[model samples]
Target: MANLNPYLSFRTEARQAMEFYQGVLGGDLEITVFSEFPDMVQNPDQSDLVMHAQLTTPDGLVLMASDTPDGMPFEPPQGFSVSLSGNSTQRTQEVWDALADGAAITMPLDTAPWGGTFGMLVDRFGVPWMLQGDSE
Candidate 1:
């Protein structure tokens, strides 16, 4: 089966952002630094930058990210959000609260028109997320 995962790019915050996500999402995180790959080492100043980071949550969610090498243009994510839906309402609310730390809430998590809890927020790492609680 094929899988589609969100790939995020950060200027130099990939390591921090991915680590934060691991804490919030409770996952196994594997990271590789730019210095680890000699061929990919473009700037010594950014040698510690995360060349690749992947977090796989126990719920089967996978997120991947990398830092933009120095001398390359970096733009924060916009226009799209990483949407999360959970089977358990309690777990869903737990995640929402965790992500709400230092987040800019675009919408308060509350009863939606469709009767499910829904909300939007941009986390401190500048990543946007939409959370939906149990549909039923």
Candidate 2:
């Protein structure tokens, strides 16, 4: 069996970002720093950087992330949003509100023309998100 999950790239905030997601999504997060794999971290300064972080939610949502290794170019997040949609309005709202904390709301959560509540925001970690709730 196999599943496709979103893998994110951060300059150095993978730990904080993963923790934030865990709080919002209710998940178990496992993090590994570059130092854990000595061979991969050539620079001592980068040893403390996140090599890998995984957050697995009870609903089976998996979010993975890591920091850019030494000498790798960092690219700012753009052009995409991690979207969440479901029939549970209450649960969707709760998740939206959680992600809204200190996040820049590009579109306030509201009833969409296509029906249902929809919203867009860029989290503090610079990750974009879209949330949707059931129409009715």
Candidate 3:
């Protein structure tokens, strides 16, 4: 089966962002630094930059991220969101609250007209998210 997962790009904050996500999503995170790779470090300063990071949630959600190489252009994400949807009201609300910390809320979490709880926000790392709970 094919699956679609979000791959986030960061300048030098991939490690922080992945850790934050793990805390919010209850996941195990694996990260590799550029220094870990053979001859991949371009600059001494960038040695500790994340080359790759993956967060796998208990529910099978996988989020990947990496820090852009020094010569590559870095653009923050826009025009899209990492949508989280499920039937667990408690878990949904917990995620929403966790992501709300240091986030800019675009839509407050509340009962939506569709008969469920819904909300939107951009996390501290500039990743947008939409969280929706089951119909009530």
Best by lDDT: 3
lDDT of 3 by residue, 8-113 (tens): 9998889999999999997799999998985998787889999999999988999999999788898889999999998576778999999999999999999988
78 Cα displacement, candidate 2 (Å): 0.7
Which pairs of residues have clashing backbones in candidate 3?
A: none
- Poorly placed runs, candidate 3 (over 4 Å): none
RMSD of each: 1.2, 1.3, 1.1
Instruction: Give a tens-digit lDDT track for model 1, residues 1-136.
Output: 9999999999989999999999989989999999998888887888999989999999899999999997889888998999988646677788888899999999988877876788899999999999888766
Better of 2 and 3 by lDDT: 3
List of clashing residue pairs for candidate 2: none
RMSD of 3: 1.1
**Backbone collisions counted per model:** 0, 0, 0
TM-scores, all models, native as reference: 0.95, 0.94, 0.94
Clashing pairs in 1: none
